[model samples]
Target: MRSRHPLRIAAAALLAFATALPLAATAQAAQPTAAAGGVLYKKINSGVSPSWYTPEFERRLLASGTDGVRLPADATLPGGVTAPQAAGLVQPGIRPGQWLLTLLGSDGSDNLLGWCSANFVFKKNSTWGLGTAGHCGVVGQPVSAYVVPPPASGKLPGLYVIGKISLSRDHGIGDDFAMITISPEFSSWMNPTMPVWGGPAGVHTGDQVGEPLKHFGHGTLIGTGGTPRVGAALRWDIENGAGYSWAGAATPGDSGSGVLTLSGQAAGDLTHIVADVEGNMIGVAGTRMTKILQVAQGWTLVNGSLLPL
Candidate 1:
């Protein structure tokens, strides 16, 4: 079981934005009868609520931490996995249209693991259409990926998959990381209209320090994300580092989770989604929404579901 290129995993909009700012940059899978990645990687802690937390986001917390919360794990490498991959482990508090990520193995060979949350969407019939960096979907390239659905969710059940990604270009996978549509039958257990963190739709997605954020998972209660409200796209010293957060902080297993406002509004997906999946923050993952939809393998938010727009 190999994982997606660790080196390439860090290739996304975060890198491009970080480069422009003269700041540094940042940074799944599964089994069904078996443990696909997302099932095992559960959020153990509670996301901290930043003062900047907006009502818009707090709404997302509506059903967070209830039951069925788990994180997806990647089976590519030798446990060289994403710490935040656990988001899928615990049942999310929200519904469909929630964001989800499928962590793959090192070599992109199989449907090993995955991670997902309220802000993401889990699609079906994606054998020919798995998830990949938005940039991975080139105009003329043949992009085939992997997918795996999560086990039956007692509460907010849904489909999941570990994506085996293949990119046609280097940066194509970035900005436009892509995920195809899922079938409604497999997407039954979970809803498609609730706030991922308990917030409403079309909430603020961009913000800076002193802002509020929160993470809700399984590892620890209040033992999760949502910290001091760090700056958005902070162009820091590449020499010292970039986007280093003293605030808007996070803990392990909080990776790939969306950062919401205290109001429960969906703010932005955490970058590199990991604080230290390895040990340091130098190499983490970041999700680029704007670019994610620009790819040939389009993405859409339909009736709260993220499908091929």
Candidate 2:
């Protein structure tokens, strides 16, 4: 496997995503474009520096339960193992958001992978859902939000393995991504919660590579402090075409967070894998408020303003 930085992952993914959109969606797509990074909270430790690595490296970011970032400039992930194979396998803690979700049964039991988590779309009537990496949520399985915590908290921040998970018809492995459909029941759990502190982070789209953007989320599972919508925020002009910031990319635990820009504008949600942060890359952004509208059971313009989904 070839190694990749998070930035490269985001860029490469976009290339594939554009090429593989469902025929219906592809018809609506504007065209292939360029982009860059920035995300929520702190970056996850991942234990490995390179967000993406080669199978031959063997120096994975985790020891078990989900370790390692997968990427390379020209090769697919999990294809490298050159790292000190044995030494790179250290167990990392499972935090929601970044942890890959898995489901075992539909008994409504917490049978999903402890490492999985989700970023849901809160809605009324409890019919909310979210979009996540395709590999995690598939046809007939449950989605995992957070692994069983150390038991110290007795509570995790994501959904439990209670029901079925649905993916977007556009999902693709060759694209290395997926969209997750959740239930409104899962939205209730994240009520009155914004995950990180500061302000009501929002999401916006139709942005140019040079347009300004901001992000917010827990620094990966590594435990880091979050920054408010203040200070000299990084610009979204680093990569190409149109891009976000690299330093602000989300970490392991920030999978489903939103990426809103200042001025209460929706830039895009921290949806997919943002690129170029710590290690190989960082931010892996996906859809923002615009897409959120697609799955949002309902919508309301709070204070005459569209809230970031």
Candidate 3:
């Protein structure tokens, strides 16, 4: 059999999602238009249909009974090999906040392939995990995140590690989202809470046009507002995919960044891909967290702990 390109796989998966509209809830949509401040908004419906994952495949995967979804043995993941961790003793930190994850290549070298974010941190059955964009890693790719270097002493720089990606939904498989299962030993370092502007109780459906959206991302390790309120409401580009667009062009490492409402509700995850015009990214789109948690069985969307904004 011939190998398929990742883009091709993503396109196929999107097509499948588009065809499965009836499976999704009916959402009121608004007309797509170019708005001020470079924000454009759109909405889409949900669906059920026959695609890559047949009724049987979906049945078994969802029935796996694990804390995470389990794929069949034959299911192919990108980067068939894992990225090797850097040699020598290193103290990397894990936290439930915006993160930058580096995707490794099969050669165990930094191919500089994918860069994304760990949107949030959550615990299931006492296990800690980080959520991110699915395209960021292969099934078992060696992923890394920023960690506070030693010392309850003076604050120092951050560190990185071989944090592995366990569960994922490739664009070709489901939506573009994945869960990075952190080791239970690293529980002290992770927090699933978020900055509160209001009640971000749990996963809620998306908003309509003119609704304001703020995306949290690592812009620069500098500046007071470096990582908050990064985007404006756009539109939902995909029909049943539950995809939403927003103003702002996402940089190379911006994928998987978490988008939220000013009220602190979860919005969606930043996709690695964006709509560009003459090399300028006009807007970015992502799979709604509501839809992701719904479709990706066993994945929980919870408000870890309430924190004031």
Candidate 4:
């Protein structure tokens, strides 16, 4: 008989932060208005049900960050891929677990493929970037921040092209991540803080079963309203370099969310959901940070503040 439960990688749905010190919770604002800044309008099917990818839903996804841009040398790019034309200014205070990233199709079409949560901020020398699941897109696929929601005016919001998939490893459980090189035009909006929790004080190496894990994701299904999820590591797969947790389960559209230990150490990236043959949800699994850092050599996690641009 087939195993009762099977592990499934949480695919992008087309659809945060902190370690120990508790920061005062900030009220998550709804979608940004044209008055907030100019909105980019586009026409494309977002793969899934259009109703599910609405503005209210995007608001539930949470909005953060400021506006600015600057290109950096040493930025990684897939051969022959060039950055898309930059659009709307990124909101101030942009941080992980905040913006919903919509991945455009790789076939040179305008189709809105799917989306995933932004995980951590990283810097390789002077270049800054964002992290998510490798399965989100292939190398050189264009990516944009899902900022403005679908408006009543009936025009679909245009994308704020941020960068392209610079590096990715969708091999399997212990190795699922992608790095996006932020276009210099949108670089200054980067923030290293996790939303609710704080430090990610540093990178965590091994597993600590029973230790609580904290996550802040914007998956469309859960509608968290910008709140963080709390759960504990239930087990570890040493061979795969992955950890499983029961509570604080990750849902579809939550792929690539960052996971941190209670004390704020960066743990790993949530890659998939564990479920049973009956289709009952079990828990969530993530690649350990130890493995991610090892595979993503040369890139270092940015903790508190970003170095001067």
Q: Report the number of the highest-TM-score candidate.
A: 4
All candidates in order of TM-score, best leading: 4, 3, 2, 1
TM-score of each: 0.38, 0.42, 0.59, 0.64
RMSD of each: 16.4, 14.1, 16.0, 15.9
Clashes within 3 Å, all models in order: 130, 75, 18, 27
Candidate 4, 129-154: lDDT as tens digits: 78887766778876666433223323
lDDT per residue (tens digit) for residues 221-248 in model 2: 2212222221112344322313334223
Off by over 4 Å in 4: 1-91, 106-112, 147-159, 238-246, 305-309
List candidate 2 stretches off by more than 4 Å. Answer: 1-100, 104-117, 124-126, 146-159, 169-193, 197-203, 206-247, 251-253, 263-266, 271-284, 291-309
Per-candidate Cα lDDT values, in order, are 0.30, 0.33, 0.48, 0.54
By lDDT, the candidates rank as 4, 3, 2, 1
User: For residues 248-271, could you state the per-residue lDDT of candidate 3 as single tens digits?
Assistant: 434334456666665667777776
Model 3, poorest ten-residue lDDT window? Answer: 42-51
Which of 2 and 4 is ahead in lDDT?
4
Which parts of model 3 are misplaced by more than 4 Å? 1-93, 103-110, 149-157, 172-174, 195-200, 219-226, 272-279, 304-309
lDDT, residue 292, model 2: 45
Query: Candidate 2 clash total?
Result: 75
Per-residue lDDT value at 295 in model 4: 69
lDDT of 1: 0.30
